[model samples]
Target chain A: MPFKDFSKGLVKANPLFVLVLGLCPALAVSTSIENAFGMGLAVIFVLVLSNLIISLLRNMIPKDVRIPCFIVIIATLVTIINITFKAYLPSLTESLGVYLPLITVNCIILGRAEAFASKNPPLRSVLDGVGEGIGFLLAMLLISFIRELLGSGGLNFTILGYKLGEFTIPVFSSMPALFFIMPTGAFLIIGLLLGLFKKTGVLR
Target chain B: MKENVKRVVVLTIIILVSSLSLYAYYTSTEDLIREQETAKLTEEINQIFPDAGRFVQKEDIYYVYSDDGDLIGYAFKATGKGYGGDISILVGVNNDEDLTIRKISVLSQSETPGLGTRITEDEFISQFNNKPIDAIKLRSNNGEIDAITGATISSNAVVNAVYTEYKNKIKSIQR
Candidate 1:
């Protein structure tokens, strides 16, 4: 009835808003839409692959040592992605830095493995991973969009090598709010967005 | 009894397979990974010296040479303790005593995001481009570079790094 487990990570058990896991990179890199998108994709890659691998080998992992095993698997996957990104997407990799490696403990990876993968069929677990990943990506991208536009007074980027025109708000451009790009800015944006979501029934 | 033994063997086989797969991936990709890293440095060097046809390395310094084999300038990396972590900057000096700054990239830093990271922004690094070697300091300190508001630690880190490196490198070149 619940589509096994894939449907749960969307909203009822969202990783960022609902579960409140992996707040470090969420706050650290969410200043701009581009940074948030890259970070989200990196997290997705780590989560989905780790879940699939763990689910496939769930039977072999002993219960007592399962946590350690999951960590190793997640860490190795993260390293591979990190290396590949460095080779191919040097700019994004440089922007990511330690946050890439820190994905091993992002809670979303291990949380999915333990909460959903272990209990569900391998295919369902994979879908669940995808759902949660998309959810996180969407949430991060939205928050960063507002932050970058407001804080920097402009959004200039070339996504996948295609240029998006420089976005600038005239008022903010002339006098950009310094706080929107700060650590506290991330908190303020996310908190207000969360409140807005609740008030508008977007989260309920 | 036979079924139980078979189950044990299967589990062991899965463990071995997974570990071997990862190990194979790591081993095969290691060389390619190293090459990628070298390519990155080479690319950065090219950006710093658009006219530099090639370069040579002596010790840790890179000597950029033009197509005609003339010495264009000397570029070297400097690491300074920043608010968050090590701030690595590429310093290039021409024969005329003018500095190109080449680039001032943050290799790693933990300073407050937005505020501190802004130090790497072009507006900040642009201040160093073509700057005379002696004029590297915070505008507040009677130099030309403007400090990022509320990010004095990060701002000062870049300023100090350039100042200290300029002084030391000048002395070394003179000797």
Candidate 2:
């Protein structure tokens, strides 16, 4: 039962595709695999912790003021993540910019707090958070892989600002499709993916 | 009436706890964050002035010194509104009479890839080197700089920023 709660979010309740929540960061930061990974990690950190805290305090939080309380908790966690990133990962901090702070209002975090965390026990809520967070991460990676590969004609891997390895495709590197890196590309790719998922019944 | 009191108390407690923890975390990481920024600035300065020894900051300008402690040139940041976002350039100027540009390195930019981003290439940046401050404008403006073929806006942004910022900061360096 506990495992079911965790695995459900991986595909069935996938936050980006299934539930279709939190597309702002998805579209904005999915330009590069590195940026997508960074944003995904940050989201997971906030989601898991916020879920745990909200679930533990569900009883103490009154129904009338629960939304405000959840916002406060989520905002606090986001700020902490921002400070940590600025200190240790300054490059990522610069890249993420306003989108990092905007995570406080990301419907996924708040939605989970209101829907799953506030109603379930702490353990179950945490599992839901992890499952949903990973689902978001996987979706982001998939989108970025396509965008960065087609847009930039290459892929570069970095962990904590350290370059792991990178390679460029032969033909694509010389004459890559520049459109794939733009905002228009993001919208088009996401829309097509959404359609594909629905057609294949992954979303249904 | 009693339920209202409970709501107020719980909300108040939550806010208080959140603020306290956030404050604690911020204080702990404040020094580390500041250190990273300063280190980054120093590295950028060194890149612009490879042989630079010590740098002194007065206002927004940095006075670069040689290994023997003699003043070599001036270095400062120029910010311009680019196509995507603000473009920041670190400019190095020789201490000559005309204050000719020694070198320039882009600190940060968010311009379009492959086009606007070509501003960072040596082909564009090299044009600024050893040129007089007055010649910072594009050739279209009767100046020495050449605008990137497809990235006029991004190129113009860097040229204009360097010209404007140099004019603004020259007086302080001259003093």
Listed in order, the DockQ scores are 0.28, 0.86
Runs of candidate 1 with Cα error greater than 4 angstroms are A1-4, A157-162, A198-201, B1-23, B81-86, B96-132, B138-155, B169-175
Worst 10 residues of 2 chain A by lDDT: A154-163
The CA lDDT at B85 in model 2 is: 97
Candidate 2 docking band? high
Candidate 2 residue-wise lDDT at B137: 91
lDDT string for model 2 (B1-175, tens) is 9999999999899999999999999999999999999899989889888898989998988999989998999999999999999999999999887899999999889998878999999999999999998888999999999999889999999999999998888878853
Local accuracy of candidate 1 as per-residue lDDT tens digits, B8-113: 6655665576577768877887887788877877777777778888877776677888999988777777777777778888777664545445555544565655
Q: What is the lDDT for A125 in model 2?
A: 95
DockQ of 2: 0.86
> Which residue segments of model 2 deviate by more than 4 Å?
none
Task: Give the TM-score of each candidate.
Answer: 0.82, 0.97
* Model 2 interface RMSD over true interface Cα atoms: 0.9
Best by TM-score: 2
What are the TM values for chain B, all candidates?
A: 0.75, 0.94
